[model samples]
Target: MSMDAVTLPDLSGRTAIVTGANSGLGVETTRMLAGMGARVVMAVRDVDKGREAADAVRGETEVRWLDLADLASVRAFAKEWKGDLHLLINNAGVMAIPESRTKDGFETQFGTNHLGHFALTNLLLEHVTGRVVTVSSSLHRRAPGIEFDNVDLVGRYTPYRAYNQSKLANLLFTLELQRRLADAGSPVLAVAAHPGYAATNLQSHSGSRVQRALLAVGNRVFAQNATAGALPTIYAATQDVPGAAYAGPKNMGGQRGAPALAGRSEAAWNSVAAHRLWALSEELTGVTFPLTSSTG
Candidate 1:
């Protein structure tokens, strides 16, 4: 379907929180959600930038600080949130970059993309009444599987591989979250979406100047802007999609078209991997899911 802001239903009474709402797909997602009457909270690592971006959005919107690389920040955001949350869009993410560690001492991409969101989701599961939408990437297909032996990759770390692992983890996390919710007889839906080749600051972290320049040209020629790229996320959050469903662009290798159900790598659908990742996430983040009867 050609889902857009005009097609999205009025969300006047609903409340949503979007992580990394300062730029890229996060900006557009927040704009549409807020414009559609949802009380949208822009959770960002930079309060100043988040406020600046929030100014560009209409409807009831607020800015909150949330550093996905920091578990304390996630907990703080959850503690401050008082009312029921209808939507939690896990949109903020870091792409390929130099190997580093988050404040919590995990690999940066894996920490922020998978574990951080995992912790945040479990923390806020009690207040999320409607759904959770996690942003993944088509690059997930490149991942062999979850590396249970060595998550950080240690001496084997590479930019693309680490990113691929994190993206795959995003899908695995979504599938597992939905499975657990269903098993517990909960109504909350867990879905995943990928913004295919979108022109955003997501690439600003790339360490290769040559690659960045080439990508800039490619983005101008082949990539969609954040506005169009955000459709899949908007669709996943608003549509009555089934749990574990994946959404992405419906054309050009999932890059440029209306939002629709998208395919996943064989490894992505592995329930065993999903379960293992879920267990590891719980062990690492120290946050538990199915917080309550009403929110889980």
Candidate 2:
């Protein structure tokens, strides 16, 4: 199925917040939601870049500062949000990168791509009663799983492996979030999606020059443009999707096509891992999501 063939539903009176909205898939997602009459918030790390992207969009949208590398920034952004949020797209992430740490002292890729968003999502859980979209990746299948002993990737950090771990964490987070929401009978739906080799600036983080060159070539040969790549995320965020559904392009190897239900790794479906991750996430982020027994 071609991405262009899919039709988006009207989003009147809806409110959406898209992280990393300054460019690439995030910009396109914001544009589409705004075009459908949704009030969109471009949650960005840089205000200037965000304004430029927001100005390019054809519908109503606003920009807000949100640095996923900084826990304080995530908390501040959540506190400043004032109304009900129909969609929360955790779209921002770091790709392959050299070993580094966020201001919050987490490894760069895992921190920004997983833990930071985890904190942000929990902090804003009160406002997001409709849907939450976590952008994962096909690369999630590369890593063994979450390294519970060394989440920060302390002494053994290979760029791709670290990124793979983060993406796996994303899927784990989504599934666990859905379970908790269901258990509590909350109105919020948790889903996961991937762009499936979208041509974006995310590769700039690669630590190796050779890896970056390889990525560039791969993108040129196979990657879809940002707009086409954003469909799955939009589908997860806006469609009448079932809880815990995973969306991605329905194409060869799940790349460059319309969004549809996609497959997840066996480990991603582990309830025990999800539960453990959830508990750890709550402890690490210092944010407790209220779960009631009535719905479980």
Candidate 3:
């Protein structure tokens, strides 16, 4: 979507928590949300960094420490937070990093990108009254369905493959969560969006020099800046979108343009897979959503 396309609804009295709000898309998202008059909480791993970023923006904003890779941190943040939450933006993620594990011992990519957000959402379900906007990626379209058995990539691991798995999980999680929320007669909506190919700090952690060089070139010539990349997210959060809607750029095969309803891959449409992933997430995270007893 065009960076300037979305005209945010007045979020005057609303409150939002934007994960990884210290950099890239998170920074822009926080800025825009604050501009719209929301109490933007910039949740980042580093409190000092978060405050620094928040200071750059003009509006009511707060900084909090949240290490999504650590479940304890997630629960702690939820516990300490007060009042109704109008928005929960799950935008923090790790891309193609080397083999690693979270503090909980799960594969770094899946744990940080999917499991962490999964646990956080469930834990804070009661607090969410409006919508949950989870940031996913176009790379998910290329993934095979999630490998339930080898989620951690113990013996078999490829940076891109693992990253793709996590991104796909993000979409599936959104689908199933929306289904359950609707079934429970809840007003909370679950939405997903992708930034397409945005130039962000997400690429800085990898160790591949060749990939870095290519990305540096591509980012300047082909990719949009973080501000434009954040339009899909802003659209998803502010627009009257339906549950499970996937928003992204509508130009250049969704690489960059104005925010619109983007298409999902066939695998992303598999309800059976989404349900299975939901169950797996509950088992792995030990956090359950507030569904009917029969549903759970």
> Pick by lDDT: which candidate is best?
3
Rate residue 108 of model 3 by lDDT: 92
Score candidate 2 by lDDT. Answer: 0.88
Arranged by lDDT with the best first, the candidates are 3, 1, 2
The residue-by-residue lDDT of candidate 1 on 2-34, one tens digit each, is 354436778899999999999999999998888
lDDT of 3 by residue, 220-250 (tens): 8999999989989999998989999999999
Angstrom error at residue 187, model 2: 2.1
Give candidate 1 misplaced runs (Cα > 4 Å).
1-6, 291-296
Which candidate would rank higher by lDDT, 1 or 2?
1
Tell me the tens digit of each residue's lDDT in model 2 across 85-162.
Answer: 999999999888888899978888898998888998888887886899999999898877788888887788888888
Q: What local distance difference test score does each model get?
A: 0.91, 0.88, 0.92
What is the TM-score ranking, best to worst? 3, 1, 2
